[model samples]
Target: MNPMTIHVKQQKHDLALAPSRVVFYEQMQLVETFDDQSQCHMLFFYKQKYLTAVRTTRLKLHSYVACAFKEGTVYESPHPFLQALIETNIPLQKYSYPQLKKKIARPYSRQEQAKILTFFESFIPKKQLFQDMKSLFYQYRREGNMSAAYRVIRVMRDFAPNNRFVKEMANDLSYRKLANLYLEESQTLMERDPLFKEMCASFEDHQRLLEKEGRWIEAYTHQLSHISNQPTSESYQSYRASLSRHFDSDSRTYILEELSQAIPSFQPVTEDLFHNHVVNENVNAVARLYTERELNLNEEQFKQVEALLEENRFNETPENLLPFMKRITAQHPDQTRKLLDAFVIRLLETMELEQVHDFLKAFKKKSSLMRKVERMNEIHEDLDCMQELGELYYGFHQLEKSIECFQMEMELKPSAPEPLRWLSKVYADKKMLDESKAYQQLCVDVQKWA
Candidate 1:
């Protein structure tokens, strides 16, 4: 080893002690130069976030890694070189300078360099896990088990609760020390538990694997299985999340229905799982949900729902607006039908094609909001939602589908020129001149007949 040049080779371990104002540095190092020799003692410095500070501690000739006590508000370090200089009262004029920078680790193998790199790569996202890791790291550090310490410290630097913790851990987790450490098995009894490793595999880990294997259904199945054992609101929430992630409403419904039947009590976990999970996500599913029982709102709330819908659209809402309407419909079918029709209309009316031509189509297919309106016609036999829908279809240039809707509307309200007029436009678009002219003439005839 080169003679002690009063410092060690260091790198910047970007860690903040406080917010941005109080930062820390690490990787204390010493360099030997060929030209001359001077006292080199500085290591770490701190600067908060981005603000310029006059007294900011930047790594310079005076930096020091420390262990000290405080006489008052200020701290004092007990580093050996610091103590030597302070006690001896060494003058700056006597200090000699060196030429070439002393290179460290040239003698180590590539494997050693890789191990040092690995230390920097390890980090845990969970604060608690990091803290636990640090506790383990310290135990190994004290025992001079540098390999385990490297592992633990690597995780800490990545996921430490704060930057100060990082700087402190960095000093102990120095790359220099890592060269001396070698990998070995854990000796502690707690770490010896087979179940511990199994438990360490988080839901995220399992999900990642399943997703990578294109087994979303398996992930969903796993969550369902996990919920069966745990049986908590959170577990069920995870189950719901898995359902959302893996399956569309159709598949989700199928999976959920099967799960509900298999686990009799799964249905009760959320009072309105269909309305909550299925209806909101699937438009066609909402149309099918008309037969199910509602849960919360009363008849009086229908007026409020209408007033609320009129005031501001439920464009961005968190409340279970769909199920709340379901509850209202349970009480007042006629009024609820009207309000729901209006609500669905508002969404459909605004569902105009924006930049993407398929935006409205996507929305219509996804949320089943338009299906909700169709259900209103089923309940009341009054709101001719098909007429409005046909117009919407025509607006979207879905000619054949528009004609179907208009034809359906005409069956409900015969002698209506609206459908005849739309059929004419669609035929024109299809280049069926005869049929287009025929409907065009029939539109005028219907108007006169009316």
Candidate 2:
């Protein structure tokens, strides 16, 4: 329905003589009316819930009507809010009294605000108006009264028209509401309700809010969608200028297609962006790419490797893990230490200890890895690596080899309790009770001294 228009000159004049001022924006609905006896009333719903009703003479009706979103309410009042009821001085000549009278739902009395709201409820969106009336209705309806709720529903539903908010709410309320608020109604009718430009602005606002909450993926997805759907506005020119910020646009296309299609006269950015590279998923391919200097590992590419590693059985076939360890260490040794530990621990977690010895034997047979392991300072002195190797030997009944690791651990550092502790266990496993007791006493002594 067409909203009422307030006569700003008359409202400004009224503002001077008023004793109270009530200013509100974000209008939900408005109506001006005259009863059968010509007693005029105006109702205004502001900020989604504030409903102000005022009784007035028909002489100054234009000032009682609604205005633009920034319109204010200035009046003398008993309490905090201004009250007005409107059914006259329609914003446009299209709405006449007889035409409005046909739309009224029921008989109206002199002082019945409830019936009065019902009479012209068809002029407003049913859901929003009902919600407004609900705030008002429940004030009268007490103690979780179903009857009052039902009664209020029945009264408003009979007259409330389908408001845009209620209608678009079925689709998507947030998008529609912001669309209507920012773009002119005619601008939005171009099929994409937000018309691309509006969407860019809204997305930027939404992304900042998402970023404040540390939702990186959600914010990135929004920017990605904005670029994907292909908005042509200069508002998104800065976004088009940097196409790979949120994603691997090199993974998308060599050229920034959105900027390529922009209107040269309107777009702020005149040049198109071109990036080149492939996100290699296979670890071997990635290693080659790094060697050739054709690609680099980012968090996204690293995630791809992790996902690929998750799918493989590192314990069942040492081929994938063994080569992967070799390739990563060769391609990016500095970066692969933590990754290698993760790979080793994952394999050990799933492999039987007895098979680990065979797996390690097969692993060491890879000449490339043998060379890398011999020269690699990465895990050379790592105590965790030695301890894992020692445990693997102990699991397979290689007592002497396990004892060698424990002895190396004692020599690798001063006198760690862990090596002493392991030495005690290995001796006990060998049935040398005297040696075991001696190592255990040394462990206890070390623990106390340290």
Candidate 3:
């Protein structure tokens, strides 16, 4: 069936204005007639739902037409529809819905506002929607809802795609002194924005000015503020470098003590402070910081820790090795296994066999298992390792590794039932039921042939 369309006409010139006449047409036939623009809006805005309601209630035309044309009532409670209408107006001047006119209007959440903006994009005319969304973007900025304001820019981009202002809102907010607002969208913007270069340029400018005036303590405090605001690796390094250049040992300790007393409630601060401690070779302080948060060591830092461990013959206490091992395990399989091997050897001196088995199970050995499988394949040139390794991976809930191992086994030993059966189970666990059934059939065929 052809969809419905609404036509609205108002008395253009009159001594007294008449109500706007609205007509609904379906398949080129006049389906309904009304004198309310709001009803006309319902047909277009709510679209199919309101149309479905109209079709279902056509038998009671008198009551249905009367109810639909009422001043502030629609299909649902007028709050949401009124909110939608207010959004349609962009700046949301006056309420068309009488109930909302006198009530205190609660501002919609960022999520709700995004939904309304999305709805506007759906049915509103392209030119008008663009203007309305642009107005909304400014409104959000004026209201200090920077996160939602940035999201409005995204919505505008989705609609216009090549809009110059939308592009500028994202790329040029730094020049507009709205970079902090943009950073609230995600702090990774510190790392991503080339202008900021992971450090607030304005903060750096202030620090440089203070230093030139011989206000070293004030300049150093500005550097700390920059770190607190951004907490990026670059900002932290800048802070440390500035501190080292100006402060003697006593002064450095005093300033650091003040920093510890005035720790900001940012998780990134603690993480970066831990890194700073590591760089200064403050071993006891670094150990104490381990209780606060996990360390996010960069490649250089990881290599330093790895070298330190190698110097100690991987015989570091398990508690000390565990943190670095957790973060680097995925990328450093050999080192992780060495750490694990050290842990097992240490635990075996006091721990029972069953206790050791449970402890080993907790640290999933995916990378090590894959490495072992590859080493075995390199040495023996056989498919025997495939089934065992695949099952090991599957037991650890590492479906991707299990799939890789099973596939290699299936290719190398097509007549093997184990790989077929294991692949079926792994795929089923992964929610690929069709592939699971196919593999299950393959497994049955292999078993029958055997």
Which numbered prediction scores highest in lDDT against the true structure?
3
Worst 10 residues of 2 by lDDT: 8-17
Residue by residue across 1-450, what tens digits does model 1's lDDT show? 012222222233221111111112221111111212222222221110011111122232211212110110111232222222222322111111111101112532222222222221112124443444455566676988665555555445544435687676666535544423322223242143222222345666655655664544334445566666666676776666655553455545554554554464544543444444433444323323332433334344334445555445545431234554444445565555556555454444454323122222223232344453344335323345777766666654556657878788767777888888878888888999999999899889889998
Off by over 4 Å in 2: 1-351, 357-450
Q: Model 3 TM-score?
A: 0.27
| TM-score (all chains, Cα) for each model | 0.23, 0.24, 0.27
Better model by TM-score, 1 or 2?
Answer: 2
- List where candidate 3 sits over 4 angstroms from the true fold: 1-215, 230-238, 247-302, 313-317, 320-327, 349-357, 366-450
Please, what are the lDDT tens digits per residue for candidate 3 over residues 1-450?
Answer: 112223332234211111223322110101232323333222222211111112112222222233234431222222222222223323212122222212212444342233343332333345765675677678878998775576666556655667788788866644344445455644465433322332344665656655664545445545665565556667665665666674554445544544543554555446556555655555445545554445455677666655555455444345454444545665566655665454444544444334444445545664454344334334333466777766655654557767988899899888878888888888888899999999999899888888
Q: What is the lDDT of residue 128 in candidate 2?
A: 51
Model 1 residue-pair collision total? 18
